[model samples]
Target: MRLKRKVAMALTSVVAIGALSACGSTPSKTPAASGPKKLQIFSWWTGVASSKALNSLIGVFNKKYPGIKVINEAVAGGAGSNAKAVLASRMEANNPPGTFQVHAGGGTLLSWINAGYMAPLNSLYKQQGWYQDFPKSLLKMLTVKGNIYAVPVDMQRSNVLWYNPAIFKKYNLTPPTTFSQFFADAKVLKAHNITPLAVANHGNWETTLLYSDVLLGTLGPTQYENLLTGKAGTSWTSPGVVQATKTFLKMMQYANTDYSALHWQQADQMVAQGKAAMNVMGDWAQGYFTTALNLKPGTGFGWAATPGSQGTFAMVSDVFGLPAKLSNKTATKDFLKVLGSKAGQDTFNPLKGTFSPRLDANTSLYDAYSRSAMASFKKDQLVLVIGQGAANPGFTQAFENDMVTLLSSKNATAFTTAVESAAQSNPL
Candidate 1:
């Protein structure tokens, strides 16, 4: 077996190193192996919760493939920007990891799939008979030209409005279900010297995440989808776009001071600590509440879909893809098997604070918030996170820059015009 040979070579190398150590000589720092024997999986999940979730799956993966060492090559940064930059460098030099993480939908990273840098996993999906296991709609998102490029690990709902229950009850304020209601509550919260909304523009992507929810809440799902796919002339100068911009500005007026100084997690922590009334962010904040903050889900916090977006689920699926022409194909494929399994989903999703993409995953393993999320997923129209998921990366970046400028400018018309220009200049 290949594993047996690898073990033999390692033992011999260790003995040789021991012999050199006895001579007061330096031993080689390189791992002595016949060939590639480790599976390096790179991702932005260097944070506590996401890392724990990935590690839980690794625990299962080790049971399945004990011979292969799973290396956790995590790069820490918000939006995976730091990791994305590093990945681009590695991929440019044809030195990619065994596998890397990406989103499952829209124009995000479509170039890599189209460029043939990713191996088509269609055969693997067929071998596992997964055609019916995953939802057809989800498969549609991951597939291009009849090939599935990656395996989705979990589904995260992005448009959730998280709030402090104790704070809301203390102020006799119910969670807002519409923008009008949100503004009304903002007034009351402001009167009490409490920050109404918590937003962190530390990175462009977090602010984009916040604004995308407002875009969805304003334009609704169908129009939003049109904008992503560049249908219906899809210019950002549209009336709906203007309305969304205005709405975003209005919300910004209530946000915490020096918001750009905090990261997204710190904004969520404000809600968890009852220092702020609410935070409109993705469900990862739940993982922060439970895993890091050691707080109960429904008891410690409250959640609803972002105002006026009740029937839509703004989603981001964290997916993994094998590098092109992998040296350790067998190990990477075996890891992919774990990524797509119900058992793997069960172990990973609960800890990750996201729901399993698999319909058959054991829901019992998820928390109360996740169970509700899972239920809503089936009912809500699945809208992609435009800034991070649906739109082209270049366009998304430009849009983020426009949005950040708009935060200070408060010039909705110029913002919309700049966004329209960005949309026209970039390819979908």
Candidate 2:
């Protein structure tokens, strides 16, 4: 199904206001009712690690507001494709949940804001002193026309390369930091009858995600951002895009033959079981490794920035916003208060395998991998992840479709042409 197409249709009004800056009036607050209420929290976080993290956050909310009942409306599959479809239906029917998880960016959250489906949280942010808590860059992402629409809970680094330490050591190999070194390592691994890279395209967005990293690694962060933002000198068919696409196609040669059939978690499992030497995925794989596979960090697995992407952090954040016209507005605000709290973020992000977007979160609660990521998030150049929340839904949909075709055709020229056309139609 064309999931992003549905999203684009639902949020068609976003295009008109896409270029507007973050400036707007503050919304008035709604006082809490004195009786018990039920709040439905919606998301696509049914996986073992994500589900556990959600439960922990809900448990905190429950303890604080015992009079409110939280209903988890989590739908599984497609890395939120299924959940987005369900959410769109509920929103259209005016059966919006109390609050729902959304990615923090113009392409995702701004669509909901511009469509008038979300409530501005400026008053809430002021009440909670969140302006100082979250980083300026993060809050900026959730803002449009001076109104902040969502509260980001966690920060995940998308440009991560996870490798099996045992497999690397057995081959006397280390993580590669450049494409030349990556191919060299792949050659060695392949000679030993090992899959060099573990990949999964079940959701059709994984390869697109990989290509985003390849773009950043190839063009550097500035040019990559320029291309996405439709800068004057940058174009989708530029030499950098061509090189990145070629690199992406070459990397696929080292991936598993069954990549089309496996889920993302299954691809992570390939590295866990030593069937594959490496996988390039978001740091969420850290949660699956530690929580589901019972593997320890540092020794069990090693991680690095995707080849040539060092000193840059590609981020995908999961945020929640107060939907407009909710009966449990007070309860939802209460939940948002907790969600954006330092205590709540510290409780949730440790188990979720991500860093809290709040700058002052307790670092001791996180693991070695997460602590490292947190450090990078603070000092490195940050970029939004494509196919997650960086680009508009129309472009994201076209990009995913093009990646799927490139998998079979391996036609780099055709890939660039299609993507350039998508950029023109979608306007970034």
The number of the candidate with the highest lDDT is: 2
Q: Which tens-of-lDDT digit does each residue in 1-428 have in candidate 2?
A: 69998898768757545534222212332344555587889999998778999999999999999989999999998778889999988888677888998887757677788789988999999998999987787787888889889999999999999999998999899899999999999999999999999999887878888899999999999888888877887788888899999999999999998888988889999999999999989888888898888898988889999999999999999999999867557889999999999889989888777889888989999889999999999888878878879988888898889888999999998999999999999887
Q: How accurate is candidate 2 locally (lDDT)?
A: 0.88
Model 2 / residue 101 / CA error / Å: 0.4
User: lDDT tens digits, residues 354-387, model 1?
Assistant: 8898878787887899999988887778878866
Error (Å) of candidate 1 at residue 357 is: 1.1
Quote each prediction's TM-score.
Answer: 0.88, 0.88
Model 1 earns a TM-score of 0.88
